[model samples]
Target: MSAAFDYHLVLQSASKLDHALELVWSDGKTSTFHYLWLRDNCPTTLHPDTKERTFDLLSVSADIEPLSFSVDNDRLMIEWSEGDHHSQFSGEWLREHAYAGDLRPANKPRARSWDAQFLKDMGSASFNDLTTDDAALYSWMKQLDQDGIILVKDMPATEQALDDVAHRIDYQRQTNFGVTFEVRSEPNPINLAYTALALPLHTDLPNQETPPGYQFLHCLANDTQGGESVFADGLRVLEDMREQAPEHFELLATVAIPFRFHDETHDIQHHHPMINLDHQGNIVELKYNAHIASVFDLPEAVMHDYYLAYRDLMGRMRQAKYRMQYRLKAGEMVVFDNRRVLHGRTEFEPTGHRHLRGCYVDRTEFQSRLRVLARQHD
Candidate 1:
């Protein structure tokens, strides 16, 4: 049923002004709906099956006004002066979409930043629970959204085990590296992740137009001497930068820098700001990889300042207070938002065995699954 028939909102009174409808709702909330807006949004304007708007603005007069309107059966009914058309909108729908005042939040959980201590207190879900229980899966995903990372333990010691968890959320993101990538020390590797050298704290694939979002690294084996995984919350680091060095934050968020990756077959390059902010000025993503960062081709006037800002952020991200280090054991998997979490690994003996199977799932898929889970549970 439409809100027009099922909703319980009661319109206290409705009056016709020169060009708008002034409505006083039962809860003492007042709203003004313009004449053109009301005519354009008539219930008859929408197709019954698709619910898509079929009304054309050109069909109505530019100075169109309602000849008369009334409140009946908890609905605001209006008769248009032009074409003798009529419209009836539910009080519930109008109040839900009111634009006269501050709107309610979307009800999504806000991200929480963490430090080194988070490793000890962080939550984890067993692979069995995640696969078997819908509530368990939803809770794990909720925590992932909150902290941008989580550890999944007690997984089966098999290659396909990682795929099972990834598919539960959505499809894996394919890149030049293929559907999934293997992390190990390989000879003449095209990426530094294939080497035993110490990898710096960085987000993966800043060079791509649309970089991968969440990353899942399943530790199939880890018997190396010293290959402790390191992670730093990029959101935490930048949040501090915004407060302590506002100038640096401004430059990094405004300037676009080049990132490039080249191999025998593929050469991917893109330019993006180091820090991306939403319209509300909240940090949404971070793209910082020193290895893949191309030469600074900025104007000389801003180039020196940009480097100073870059170094400041780099230094802050490397600080011990912001980073958490942990060595993964067999049958353990770590999933993190690649766009918000900076990850690295320490140097280890190449002779020893240390292998991890990994894959990527974009942010959109992760959020979509979460919303669906929420709907199911609700």
Candidate 2:
């Protein structure tokens, strides 16, 4: 049965307009369907084999009219006066495409933020279970979307194992750092992660033209002291700033900052607001990186205000109420949304081998995998 045939979603009565059908749904809400839309979307016009719209709209006259209309149990049936054509539209279908000014569909998942206390355990999965079980993988992807992070234990402790898991979701996003880079203490480090330093909470690769949306880090060995993983929701912090200090939130939301990554081979630079907003003024991206940030080129007065907002945001990120810290174990991997949440590590002693393999995948591919898996499992 079509979704429109649901008895609960039926329309009580329809008032046919000169150019549209004014519908009063059983639930009290109302909507209108244009005369042209009904003529073009009749079920009889749909190909029987393909069930796709086969009617040619150009064949219909611009001043089309319906000879008569009637409310059936399942649909609003229409008879065109221009021709012996017919149309039947379900009430559910009309509600789905109602032009009621909603920004997005009701079914799409909205990103919700959480602090440390809000989490139980990091969404955990065994490598073996996720690799073979489609249902398990679907759950993992949902967890990733909701939490923006997941931890998988019991990996095979091999390079191929990490690659296998990554490809199952998406392809490798190779950069100057190569397909996959090793994160061990180096004498001459090109990046801060290459050394045993307490990296601050920040987004990854903020200097890229389009920074990596999601990052994966697999702990191969971890016998050193410190180096606990840190996670924080930058958008949640921005929400706090909006309520606590509107001025600070406004400055950060509108001010663009420069981030750069320079090396012998690659010189990547990008300018983005610390808090990015969409047309609806919703936080779409939280691009921040103290490590890669370049000097502000704004006027002295503007820079002063920028720093004040910047420092306050930085301080809020460090607050215990916003952070979630967990130690990574060997054969354990963590995945996170690099654009939404900030990730970092505490300084370790550089004693023993503390190796971590890392890689990146475009968010588009990640979302594609999730949707595919969801359909398959459903």
Largest lDDT belongs to which candidate?
1
| TM-scores, one per candidate | 0.87, 0.82
Error of 2 at 205 (Å): 1.3
Give the per-residue lDDT digits (tens) of candidate 1, residues 1-378. 233322544677888776788888666657788888888877788899999998898998889987788897668988878998888898777776665422222433379999888998777999999988999999999999999999999999988899999998999999999888998764344654556688899999999988899999999888878899999999999999999999999999999999999999999999989999887678889999999999879988999999999999989998999989999998999999999999999988665678899999999999999999998874
Residue 10 lDDT in model 2?
A: 69
lDDT of 2 by residue, 203-269 (tens): 9888877788778899998887887888998778888888999899899888878899998998888
Quote the lDDT for 259 in model 2: 92
Q: What residue runs in model 2 are displaced by over 4 Å at the alpha carbon? A: 1-7, 16-21, 33-70, 77-88, 101-109, 186-194, 278-281, 298-303
Question: Whole-model lDDT, candidate 2?
Answer: 0.80
| Residue-level lDDT for 220 in candidate 1 | 86
